[model samples]
Target: VSDSGLGFSHNRFIALIVSIAFLVVLFEGASELGGGMIKAQVEQTTSKFHPEKNAEDRLKPAMVLATEANIDNSVEETSEAVAAEWSAEGSCQQVIEGNDMLQFNLKEMVVSANCKEVTVTLKHTGAMPANVMGHNWVLTNNTDFMPVAQAGGAAGIENNYVPVGDQRVLAATTIIGGGQETSVTFSIDSLVVGDDYTFFCSFPGHYAIMKGAFKVI
Candidate 1:
């Protein structure tokens, strides 16, 4: 009975050792798997946030954004420059007006010498008839302004208040009444740059007050 009890205890001891070995192997395998999973997760997070793997991949988007910003700024500056140039360099066509007070709206008229032909639009914003308070736009040199105006007054409204075949008259628009509009096209070849010129209304005696400097530059 003593031998049998000893054998049974030995068997139990061997079984316990086998079970312990199996448990150790299982735990080691589980640890290795968990470590591998953690390594993979860390790598994935680093690649997503810190993409310093390739220089091109990191800087391409930034470069594109900067280029677009530069292009937009260039377009805006170019537009502003073009607008300023247009405002400084007068155009070939202009408009002027005469009201009941016998005053021209523009104190000075600017003309571009580069224009082949210049057009002048005149509007009568007065409340009187042409025969009563007539207004006609006449262009002449400063030297011939008074004489041309006098001759035009003598010409009368029948001839649009402009002398017939007068060489001193550079251009003239017809006499207009209230709410009337007239325009005249004249060649720029006859205009001299830096020369003094005068534009006035030759309506009876309205030249003195209704005149302005006409400049060709």
Candidate 2:
């Protein structure tokens, strides 16, 4: 009698497994009712245990389910900070205006490493002719600035007052006469963090007076 009862229990267990497998197949075959019933049962169990978790907890699935998802947010933040470190890489946008008196309104500009390309716009607010008081924006390492400016003066207005093919020239804008404006966009890959850079007007005799610091921070 005991053996017969054991055999009956084994048969029932096999039947239960077969029933579960069949239900899984039905759910996979697009049986919405079967799938919904399974989902409802699981949700009921989840709510019973996690009754305190509300809408706010549900909104941030990644944050709330970090353990379940096995994600590390600290690493993400660190990567972002490293990317923004100006010394590693960066770019900037600067705007400077010149007047008939040969003066730049800004004495300094700052660039951040988050940018891949920087753009500079030079506006000639003065009404003077390019021959008399033309203005252009030029950038170079601070140490080479005086020499480049001297060479650029000789290079003349035809080259926008800048020495042509000068590798020291990080970026330069076109020479503009009064009431005209120009802009130049260049990569920041060559710029290093904390390096001293100087921006000046390469127009004849202007660099001596119109110059400022370019900060990469």
Error of 2 at 41 (Å): 99
lDDT (Cα, tens digit) per residue for candidate 1, span 1-217: 2344555666677788899999999999998999999999998878656755766878989999998897567546754653355432455787888988787776677788898888899999998999988788899999999999999999989998889999999999999999999999999798899999999999879998888888888
TM-score of each: 0.59, 0.58
> What does candidate 2's lDDT look like per residue over 1-217, in tens digits?
2344555666677888899999898878776877888899999878845747675666667666874443245334543654455342333656678899777776666777666888889999999989998999999999989999999999988888788899998999988889999999988788997999999999878998789888776
Candidate number of the best lDDT: 1
**lDDT of candidate 2?**
0.81
Each model's Cα RMSD: 20.8, 21.1
- In candidate 1, the residue pairs with backbone N, CA or C atoms under 3 Å apart (3 or more residues apart, or in different chains) clash, namely none
> What overall lDDT goes with each candidate model?
0.85, 0.81
Give me the candidate number with maximum TM-score: 1
Name every residue pair that clashes in candidate 2: 90-113
